[model samples]
Target chain A: MDIKDIMKPENMVYSKTPVLTSTTMHYCPGCSHGTVHKLIAEVIEEMGIQEKTIGISPVGCAVFAYNYVDIDWQQAAHGRAPALATATKRLHPEKYVFTYQGDGDLASIGTAEIMHACNRGENIVVIFINNGIYGMTGGQMAPTTLIGMKTATSPYGRDPKLHGMPLKITNLIAQLDGTCYVTRQAVHNAAAARKTKRAIRKAFENSALGKGTSFVEVVSTCNSGWKLSPVAANEWMVENMFPEYPMGDLKDR
Target chain B: MAEKILMKGNEAIAHAAIRCGCDGYFGYPITPQSEIMETLMEEQPWETTGMVVLQAESETSSINMLYGGASCGKKVMTSSSSPGLSLMCEGLSYLAGAELPCLVVNVVRGGPGLGTIQPGQGDYFQACKGGGHGDYRMIVLAPASAQEMYDFVDLSFELAFKYRNPAMILSDGVIGQMMEKVELRPMKPRWTNEEIIKSMPWATTGKTPDRKQNVITSLALDAAVHERLNHTLIAKYKQMEDEEVRFESVQCEDAEHVIVAYGCMARICESTIEMARKEGIKLGLLRPITLFPFPKKEINRLVPHLKSMMSVELSTGQMLEDVQLAVNGRIPVNFFGRLGGIVPSPEEVLEAFKNSINK
Candidate 1:
């Protein structure tokens, strides 16, 4: 059957789920955020949490995650999405709550909030999107920016001598007793995209079980910040960002 | 049923919160107000009453936790002193913007920065006015004694849920630390989760397609939409001023001088009023109970009869500005305050009142 035939309203097997709508995406060509968002929406739809989920949107380019994700949403103060998610989950223990944050927001200004939320073992999920550079702010050097990486803020190669070493938040959170599940995944390709969705699903399931804090960090590509074509950006993330940040689960239980 | 038990101010707040059927308490330990968390921790209300008690990493996290809890239509609260409350301002604004009902108690101390742990009304402006950004107002209740502390917890929670707005108990170091005779009431949950959800169907628990997906956001990208939300907020504030204005008046019938104060400072002002009365000064006390509504009408009423009004506070003349606005230049308004842990005694307040009246 043709693509249109399968996707047609009357012919579709799954009804239009509350977790996603038919609104046209605002993402650029080859942008991975759209794919990542869709994966999350699919998981919510399959798990039947669309009616009982609250998602926090951060201050980066994906600040409007609520627009695409059909669940209830609240926009958090810059760098404070983790704290917001922590509060939201603690108040409604039965509901599935998660925060969608970028590297700049999660690792820089909101570092304290994320660290403590994990330490407190708040039953919530944190979906961290680390693109190595600040996207919306014009390619600025971010906390996870690799050594020798060049950007608007760092005109020359990033020098570990000057700027601090890259932050591996998942590894750091794994040390905290409160964190029950901490994993670093990526969405550079179709295979990695599936894995990212599985990780997100696990994170949400942990919250439902009241297992404690669950964190999933996605090493994403920012074509605008990296100054690469969408295809090249995905390749760059796999070749450069993944090696330094690594992709694996740091904590299971 | 009648019940009475002598308790300290901090303990009274904890007991009153339990009686009010608050579902959660998120707070960090700070001086004077630490007893509030301490009492709750010892009482272990979580096991008995299903109350959720969490000692957050800091005041910032505590307030955000309150935000999370309140979003679910739960009766939630967080308590701290001046410095901690300052850290909570950001979350406070978000909560107000979201229009969630929650209780925040500030046991104030002297400060521009980390001033002192002593009792002071330095947070008068921060509490009475919107402490955070945006055009919003909290339901501010100022308690002068331990008894009022116990009573206002229930009252604050009632007002919070009634309006679906954040309410504050603006207490001070003296009131928080002082021991006093207080009556503890029996425990009762005012509204169950189902009741609260039924009342606020718009709350962000989840999205049911039957209802339009509810978004609990303060952000309105469109200028007209943003402005409309602001207008609605202002109208609500005006209504709150009309409905929630509360204060206590003493010897103001045919009085020549009036002393305006609130929280612990109001208690001191009461003693000053007594001493001034003994010295034949004919000074009256106007103690503001709801500091946000500020009893402005009462002040306006006194402006015609009184020669002058003097404001006594533990801050550097913060509430005096409101007093001036209320007087509307009809009568002179003077201010006397002690900052940075310095608390003016009753005699000192009396002296200030006498001097202001003489002037």
Candidate 2:
């Protein structure tokens, strides 16, 4: 139980990836972003591609993702990370390029950018974090907000006629021929987090293989935005979110 | 041996950019400037110079793509018309704030909103002033001839990377569409990854174990820090004004009236000067090559010799305000312009100059 005993490599079964910066993240307690960022860092470290990976960070809670990840980063304008990633990959075809974007950033205003990038079959990876609500702007209804889900923007529960149905952007992108791999995973639990990490690793591997765009959607939870406890949020995601966005590979090639 | 070829202004820009060793081109076609990407595509310079050419979905995506490539310390560029450029204002602002170096060639066409596809100099205000929202400035190079279009492509990138600020080749429909003889420069090779890292230490060229990760961003949340960032940009502008002002003077040494112009209209006013000389009207011409710097000192120097000054343009006098500000009310600086894609003839321009002098 001593510090030296715990510090030994053989004694330690788990440790943070060096690819993750020591700088603290601003994600709320139990936020899925921290988990995903860690997963990506671990995978990048495992692949020994940390020196050649570049990230395009989106505008949202994760806008300052550059601070948390120890890799070259380009902070793209809101909803424009995919477009930015396209240029990065095209310019340096040898490097691994990926975009980390939120639902509001990808599914709504940036719909055109993502669609065209995917349709054009840009050799890049797109990591989409879809939590049912906008976290950064304070509990607003996001494009992936569930029906009958209440938030600041939809205080009286989301009405289908009023707010329209939540967008299944990953499913939509999966239909595009440009996307070689499309998968929906989660980070709410340990098993789900492991699966999401594998998906992210595969996406990066696919990009290196020049296999066109690879998309990995993480159906996450926003406990603070949902006004629920962290434990409750995981339970909520299991009972509610999983049915709408089932955790599995929707398409693969 | 390098060859001299006949080419359109837009094509000249494309060829010159390739010869200048541009690493990438992301553009969406717009009228009067579509030839830039078309020429690049036809050349397929990727096979030779390793230049990457991509036809983006829209102007918005094209500019953002430049933002990404420029962030990576690559020589990237994009070209578009007025309406398309309007769609890129936000990306331009981001580029400015992040201090990313890149070239933007605006083959200007008429516009307030999709005004026309014909030539216009109405974007003078947008290019000279901070086109987007923020306290920032970009090097605005106005090229008159198809040859200048070829020359300024390399020069614009040089100035852009020198100051880590965006530079624009502010051509017009007339220049973009008109053909002329161009002396092509010898081809240069694209920058290798090592060369990029050596030149742009701040560029996000991926992180190695020895080097820290680089980030290209403009977001500063703290009020004090953001204000200091604005001050840094302001100082850069002052430095550029002091060192980068460029212009051409024709017959300013012994003349009574001076005609101020730039881009395609400058070529028009040159003819007007000859016609006015025959009419016994001693008119000189001051053509600004750099619009943002405004050739203020040159205009002020010519202020003492001139009886009056007038700005001639293809728009409703967008550059006139700069000429007036340069003169600072020491004498009258009038304006003559043709709106809605009208190119003024030499006779009518001379008449307008005479009318302004008489008034």
Across all candidates, the chain A TM-score values are 0.93, 0.97
Tell me the lDDT of model 1 at B194: 71
Look at candidate 2 and give me any clashing residue pairs: none
* Model 1 lDDT at residue B341: 74
For model 2, how does the per-residue alpha-carbon lDDT over B1-359 read when each residue is reduced to its tens digit? Answer: 66889999999999998999999999998998999999999999999899999999999999999999999999999999999988999999999999999999999988889898889999988888988999899999999999999999999999999989999999999999999999999888888999999989998888987888898999999999999989998998999999998899988788888999998888988998888888877889999999987899998888987889999998887889888888999998888999789898988998888787777
- Scoring each candidate complex against the real one, what DockQ results? 0.68, 0.89
Clashes of each: 2, 0
* C-alpha lDDT values of all predictions: 0.85, 0.92
Cα error of candidate 2 at position B151, Å = 0.5
Best of the candidates, TM-score: 2
TM-score of each: 0.95, 0.98
lDDT of model 2, residue A71: 93
lDDT at B162, model 2: 90
TM-score of chain B of 2: 0.98
Candidate 1's docking class is medium
Using DockQ, give the best candidate's number. 2
